[model samples]
Target: MVEADASAPCTDPDIGNVAQARRRTRGPSLDKTAQTRQQIAEAALAEFVEVGVARCTMDRIARRAQVAKGTLYLYYPSKDELLRGVVEHALRHSAVYTALQRKKGETVRAFLRRSLLPTMDAVENSERGLLARLVLSEASHAPELARLYKELAFDAWQTYVQDLLTLAVKEGELKTRSVSRSAQLLASPFWMALVHNSLLAPDAPQKLALKPLVELLIDNLFSRSAGDNANVKSQ
Candidate 1:
């Protein structure tokens, strides 16, 4: 029989515990790396918002992040990748998606007030708003980054809102033949308003008031009968 390889991990029981201990010791280092990456993403978001994606260079982001330009490369290989990181960072921290959480027996109007209002507020009055506007403005020139933004941010919100509408239909809170269409209808006005404000004059009178529109959507679009049908379909 040949001798065991000297560099191989030990099969001894004590060695296994030691290996796990070493892994535990490395956790702090891993946390530091993640923190550094997040810092870079935040810096990149600031740069993108200030000067837009095309003009936002890796050097600017690296300087803002207080990291070496080389270190920035290690975290994000290109400006496009960095832009995607910016979107990811926003999604991870934004309250927009958190607004989707529904409580037991809450009316659809109550849910909209809790969820939709916060979303509109975030779009109106946060660094997140600037970042969103940057993405929209730059998307035409940078389709790849746009696609990534859609995949990471837009798709997530669309899926969640659609599911919320579907659940509402099942709960008899919404009257709709298609939850997909209903979700689109519910969100279109707010989205359009945000787009208008971001692209047009901020104080435009054409801005859609979220509260009244939400009330109209609920009053005209929901029905107790729809929920009953949904229950029957499930059975």
Candidate 2:
């Protein structure tokens, strides 16, 4: 009998069915898909930063990502969509945006301080800061980006803070006439520091610190005794 050639394609029906089954089951793994998406997002952000949103193009982003243009489109169909994706991805992983639950017996003020201060301390040097700067710099040029930033970052944070303030009031840890305004006040320092560092005087040797300002605000906002004293003195 003649020996079968090992190099030849298998002709046996059982072997052919097995081979077909393997082929049908094969595709990009979940890890690979996620990695590719991450690569594309990073590349898009780099392009946006380097050339501004107006000048950045899908073709350029694809080249930067080292992915086929078609592949880039598969992940993000258009520049606007890609910008949204990038911002959402960045915000999702941001320390500042992570959802934190108040510990058992933790005051809302204490929780805010514990949760926000550390993140705020590093905001000026973190990816969160970079995203804020990008939104500020491009807001005038790209209205849609500004809108998305507001929807995804600004308004979301405002709502989150508002909810916390409501909780504080319900728990009797805070006494504010308006939870909305108090939340806005609590948020103002971060924007001020961001503008001071990134826009108004980026090259200045001395930069504003966000953490201390936030810490001070937290103390004042949560000080029931101080509020009481003020009411007593005003009478």
Candidate 3:
């Protein structure tokens, strides 16, 4: 896992702050500047995919982005930092994680539809797809970053699944002694699929039929277990 200090902050330091103790002068074209930053990130992603990140240079990124190399540094201190920006941007706004919204107390099935599927959808984009593959291939070299990616992928799903089990326990729908264990069981297959897709099966069909796998997983692990959760929907 990325040690807290070592993990790069995901947002642009200048723009992400919501408030300050004292008001300061505001830039008139903040939105325009932010758009430019997004453009650079988009261009960098393309450049990195077209040429591997190891081969990509700041000069090339700048040329692709139509921004000065120094300007790119203003937004990102280093190439690694810039790459972090691209990955973070993809995580929050990409097709998969972006639309996977969940209501409080949502069921385990809802969790997958909201979070996992959208992430899987993102696997189809060339730039993001390439980056994801690169991470998988190089994770051994940078294990911390790899672990951070895993946490970003599934931590919330675990929490949401756990919450659903807790709800079921309160309703007398589950006989589980520990909600955490049940949550683990619920999220295991989804996580396993994520692992296979991200690392082991990078060249696998872009659009895998995960529902069948999900059904098999739920059937094998759940199978109307004595303590099985009733409120959590399975598909």
Candidate 4:
């Protein structure tokens, strides 16, 4: 498993606060500018998919967005920044982050279903699916994109999983020794489903469905045998 600095902030220093503050304080003009930036990002996604990232030029993106080249630069100073924008857009619009929204005292099943199932359905049908494919394809060449994916998406999901599992342990819903590793195991299959749907044969019939998988996982992970200690591994 690829490790990330858990202590690291979830958002990019260059993009997150500045833009968030602008949205909170600035009026219609900044809102309009934000919309324009989204337009450019969407256009850039189209251009990138049409002809891979290396060939997707700012000029082409501007034309596709029907905005001036200068206008596009005002939001994204470079293609890399624009790529981050695309990712941010995709993540903000997906249900993958809903795990972080779990209410205190909610059941493990409720939390997992609320977060995981919708995300699986969303990625299977939405532009986020295409975005995942695009990012994976470009990751080999653009390390920053991969880094941003970890920073913005993977780490946040893992952190939520860790928190949920920790809560489960305290509530006697789980008896895992390692919350971190258990969290990884809990989240891995859902993620693989998303990636498989995004990059593999999405429409093909699968032997396992996500709901049944979630049920079995919950049964195995949480249905601790009587007298099981904290050190007991789930079988």
In terms of TM-score, the best-performing candidate is 2
Residues 201-225, candidate 2: write the lDDT tens digits.
9899999998889999989887853
Model 1 poorest 10 in a row by lDDT: 1-10
Which residues of candidate 4, in runs, are more than 4 Å off?
Answer: 1-28, 98-105, 198-211, 225-235
How do all models score by TM-score? Answer: 0.72, 0.82, 0.60, 0.74
True-vs-predicted CA distance for residue 118, candidate 2, Å: 2.0
Residue 54 CA displacement from its true place in model 1, Å: 2.1
Ranking by TM-score: 2, 4, 1, 3
Q: What is the C-alpha lDDT profile of model 4 across 66-96, one tens digit per residue? A: 9876566657766678889987887776877
What's the candidate order when arranged by decreasing lDDT?
2, 4, 1, 3
lDDT of each: 0.66, 0.77, 0.59, 0.68
lDDT (10s digit) by residue, model 3, range 1-235: 2133233333345542222311343532668667877888888777755655555677777788998755676677666677677776656555544544557666544454455544444454545455566565556665544665566644655775677667655655455667787667655554455567766785887635455655554444344553556545544
Report the error of model 4 at residue 182, Å.
2.0
Compute the lDDT for candidate 1. Answer: 0.66
Q: What's the residue-level lDDT of 57 in candidate 2?
A: 70
